[model samples]
Structure formats: structure tokens, C-alpha cells
Target: MTHTYKINGMTCDGCRTKVENALNTIEGVQATVTLNPMEATITMEKHVPTEELQDALSAAGNYTIQMTLPPSHDGHHHQPH
Candidate 1:
């Protein structure tokens, strides 16, 4: 399965590379990190828990990762008050 995560605390290209390498170290995981969006998209051979991903990134730096939720079918992110 593939999953996208929002990464926080990345500030440069080097930061992006560090995150990418850290995540790719996991068994059966291929990760791509982008700086502009500050996100990582991972392709895994099997299910990997979000905690594990967070742990990997934490060891690398002061980075944090959270699962990215897909946009709603209605294409809206917020509701009227």
C-alpha cells in the first residue's frame, strides 16, 4: 500500500534528503520527500504503522509525521460556520 504523510520541521533540501533516507531505511518501504509541500509519500510492501514512521523520522531530527488525509469527495476542506 501507499501512504502520504505531512512532515513538519523541514527547512531545506538537506532536510528533505534526510527525511527521505530515514524513511527508506524501513524494510519494504520506498519514500519520496518533497520540500515545497513538506510531505513524504511512501510505498510499502506491507502495512506499516504510523508510529513506526514517526519513530524513524524522530531519530533523524526534530521532524514529525502524520498521516495525510485524502481530500473529501466534495473537494472542500472546511465547512461554513
Candidate 2:
């Protein structure tokens, strides 16, 4: 399945590369990490646990990732109000 996660604390191309590298190193992760919007889109061969992803981010030392919100759908936006 394809997973899109909103990542925080990534501020540069270097950080972006770092995130990509970490996730790509995982056995099942085929990931593309972009810093412009601070997100990682990952395609996995199997279900990789979310904690494993968080562990990768934490190991990077400079990246702190958290789920913000999923993309808008059905022409409607979701806001926490």
C-alpha cells in the first residue's frame, strides 16, 4: 500500500535526503521524501509498522515527524475547529 505522511522538522534539501535515505533503507519501504511540503510518500511491499517509521525518523537526529492531516478529498477540506 501507498502511505503519505506529513513530516515535521525537515527544513532543507539535506534533511529531505536524510529522511528519504532512512526510509529507503528499510526492507519494505519504497519511499520518496520531499522537503518543499515536508511529506514522505512510501510504497511498501508489506505493512510496515508506523513505529518503525517513527524510529527511522528519530534515528536521523534532525528529523521529527508527526502526522498532521491527510490530503483533502471530495473537494472538501478538513480543519480542526
Candidate 3:
């Protein structure tokens, strides 16, 4: 599954890398972090709790992450009703 989240406390490209590296450390999770939008698009093998993500972020730095609306980049396309 794929999920995007709003990431806070990033100030530069290094911060961006830190956040990305931190998130990617998780098992079966791949995250792409952007500084402009300050968000992380995470692809996971299973549904991982937000708390687990938070834990990893905390270890990397004083960063916080939360769901971005919900499945904004979950690789799903829907036809117009």
C-alpha cells in the first residue's frame, strides 16, 4: 500500500535526506521526502501504524509526520462518477 504524509521540521536538503533515510529504514517501507511540499510518500508492504512512523522520525530528528488527507498517492485511479 502507498500513503503520503505531511512531514514537519524539515529545513533543508540535508533535512530532506535525513527524513527520507529515516523513513526508508523501516521494514518493507519506501519513502520519498520533498522539502517544498514537506511531505513523505511512503509505500509499504503492510499497513503500518502512524505511531511506528513517528518513532522513526523522532530518532532521526525533531520531525513529525501525519497522514496527508489519505491516499493522495496511493497509486489508485478512479473513474469519474
Candidate 4:
């Protein structure tokens, strides 16, 4: 499953890299952190608790992560070409 989280305390590209690297360490987790939105989208092979993600970030730096609603697909849909 894929999870999106809102992250705080990231101030620059370096911060973003740190967050991403930290999250990626978790088993079965692939994370992408973006600076502008200050959020991380993690793709997991299995369900990983939110707390686990939080702990990883906390250990990495002065960062925090909270589970957030995934982006809506209200109107956008893909049509096979």
C-alpha cells in the first residue's frame, strides 16, 4: 500500500534528502519527500504503522510525520491510449 504523510521541520533540499533517506531505510518502504509541500509519499510492500515511519524520521533529525489523506482523484482519470 501507498501512504502519504505530512512532514514538518524540513527547511531545504538537504532536509528533504535526509527525510527521504531515513524513510527508505525501513524494510519494504520506498519514500519520496518533497520540499515545497513538505510531505512524504511512501510505497510499502506491506502495511507499516504510521508510528514506525514517525520513529524513523525522529531519529534522523528534528522532523515529524503524520499520516494524511491521500490526494483525491475526484475528476482525473487515465484513459488507455
Candidate 5:
């Protein structure tokens, strides 16, 4: 499913690219980030929790990501850490 998230701490295109790359690191995830509104639209093959996404973003930069909307479906949830 595709999910939208609000991203914070991006200051420029470079920062946007970094966040995008970081999010892409996770398995089965593809992310696109836009700086104007500081948001990301992510496509996932499986359920991935926000914390895992945060870990990837933290490693790349000081960015933070949170869901813009509650998940569409809670089914097939991946185990959380």
C-alpha cells in the first residue's frame, strides 16, 4: 500500500535527496520526498512501522517522519521491535 507522511528537518534539495535515499534503504519500500511541504509518499510491499522508517532517516540525517493519515489497513502488520 501507499502511505503519506510529513517529514521534518529538510532544508534543501540535497536534504530531500538524502531523506529519499535513506527511506529507500528499507526492504520493499520506495519513497519520494518533496521539500516545499516537507512530505513523503511511500509505497510498500509489506507493512513497516514508523519507528523502522525513523531509524533509516536518523542514519541519513536529522529528519523525522510520521504518518499523515492512519494506516489504511492494519492487516498483515509486520512485527514491531
Candidate 6:
């Protein structure tokens, strides 16, 4: 399933990459993040707990979720983070 999350504190491409990389590091996630829109789209291969994803983003020290993207909209690619 693919999940989208509205995130905060991603100011630059580097910040975006960090969050993206962290999310990608998870066992089941394939993450893509946009800095302009401040969001991360995560594709999972298995059942990944939402709390786990949130914690990893939190550990990056600059991300907060505004809203979570539902699975039904995986193809709705938006603008920058």
C-alpha cells in the first residue's frame, strides 16, 4: 500500500532527502518525499505500523504530520514538499 503524509520542518532538498532516506530505510517502505509540499509518499511491501513510520520521521528531528495520505490516492502525485 502507498501512504502519503503531510510533513513539517523540511526546508531544503537535503532535509527532504534525509526524511526520505530514513523512511526508505524501513524494512517495508519505498519512500518519496517532496520538499515544497512537505510530504512523504511511502510505498510498503508489507504491513508497516504507522507508529513506526512516525517515530522514524520524528527521529529526524524536523518532521511532523499534518495529515496522512490514504491508500486510495497512490497515483495522485502532487507538487513539491
Candidate No. with top TM-score:
1
Candidate 2: tens digits of C-alpha lDDT, residues 1-81? 898888888878888999899989889799899877889999999998878988998898667666556667786876899
Error of 6 at 11 (Å): 1.0
Whole-model lDDT for model 5 versus the true structure? 0.93
In Å, residue 17's CA in model 2 sits off its true spot by 0.3
Q: 40, model 4: CA deviation in Å?
A: 0.5
| Clashing pairs in model 6, backbone N/Cα/C closer than 3 A | 4-69, 34-81, 35-81, 36-80, 36-81, 37-80, 37-81, 38-81
lDDT of 3 by residue, 1-81 (tens): 889899999999999999999999999999999998999999999999999999999999999999876444767877799
lDDT of 6 by residue, 1-81 (tens): 877878788888888888888888889789899987778888898878777887898888767754463556577667798
Candidate 3 at 19: error in angstroms?
Answer: 0.5
- Model 1 C-alpha RMSD to native: 2.1
Top-down lDDT ranking: 1, 5, 3, 4, 2, 6
Candidate 5 per-residue lDDT, tens place, 11-78, comes to 99999999999999999999999998899999999999999999999999899998886655956667
lDDT of 6 at 52: 86
lDDT of each: 0.94, 0.84, 0.93, 0.92, 0.93, 0.80
Instruction: Write down the lDDT that model 3 would get.
Output: 0.93
Candidate 4: TM-score?
0.83
Q: List TM-score per model, in order.
A: 0.89, 0.79, 0.84, 0.83, 0.83, 0.73
lDDT of 2: 0.84
**How many residue pairs of model 2 clash at the backbone?**
0
lDDT for each residue of candidate 4 in 1-81, tens digit (9 for 90 to 100)? 888899999999999999999999999999999998999989999999989998999999999999886566886666899
Error of 2 at 14 (Å): 0.3
Instruction: Identify the runs in model 2 with alpha carbons over 4 angstroms from their true place.
Output: 67-81
TM-score of 1: 0.89
What is candidate 6's TM-score against the reference? Answer: 0.73
